[model samples]
Target: METFDETDRRILSVLQREADIALEELGARVGLSRNACWRRVRALETRGVITGRVALLDPAKLGFGLMVFIQVHAARHDAEWLEKFGRAVREMPEILGVYRMTGDLDYLIRARVADVADYDKLYQRLIRKVELNDVSASFVMEELKDALALPL
Candidate 1:
């Protein structure tokens, strides 16, 4: 693992919140020269500490207001089944994230769509590609906390 000092941590924390902040402005906020800040940022990127930056858009404004969490139970827990399932999930635009889980749930999928109809369409498409033992969905009523930034 790559080790970082205090300055690197400060830069990461600031950039996580405001990735579009100008180099000079970021440097000023973090108490560093613009050139120095740029070098550190580049180094962080090289070390895989900083991945990619993106604009976080509001789902409601974008017409993808409905968010649903799906618990999936696989019919067959084999390499071929997992591969096909992975491909199906990756190709679906509505599926934001999918994670292999422990306990009763085999997989957890997070998705966003326009409404119930859209969600049903997504569900149909998913079942067509892979065989699932059980599939259960829970709609998100309220999102109290959602922070993409990891603590430095």
Candidate 2:
């Protein structure tokens, strides 16, 4: 595991929220020279601490206003079933996140669509790809807090 000092934490915290901030600006915020900041960021990237940066877009503006969390029970608890499920989800662009779970649920999927009709199409496409024992979905009424930044 990589150990982080106070300055490293500050740098990471700032980067997490604003990846596009100028190196000099970031250095100013974190109390370091621009070159020093660049060196630290390089080291962090080299150590696999800083991953690729991306723009977080508004789903509503993109016509993907509805968010749904899907609970799935696998047809079979086997490698074949897992591979098929993984492939199906990976191929579907609307599927944002898929997680193998513990307890009653076999897997959890988070996705975005236009509305009920759009979600139905996504469901139809998913079922056609792989067999599922059970599936249920819950639509998000309001997003109180949606974040990608990890706490430093």
Each prediction's whole-model lDDT (CA): 0.95, 0.96
lDDT of 1 by residue, 1-152 (tens): 77889999999999999999999999999899999999999999998888899999999999999999999999998999999999999999999999999899999999999988899999999999999999999999999998898878
Per-residue accuracy of model 2 over 69-106 as CA lDDT, tens digit each? 99999999999989999999999999999999999999
Q: What value does the lDDT take at residue 100 in candidate 2?
A: 93
- Model 2, which residues run further than 4 Å from truth? none
Candidate 1 Cα lDDT to native: 0.95
Q: Determine which window of 10 residues in candidate 2 has minimal summed lDDT.
A: 1-10
Q: What is the clash count for each candidate, in the order shown?
A: 0, 0
What value does the lDDT take at residue 31 in candidate 1? Answer: 98
The most accurate candidate by lDDT is 2
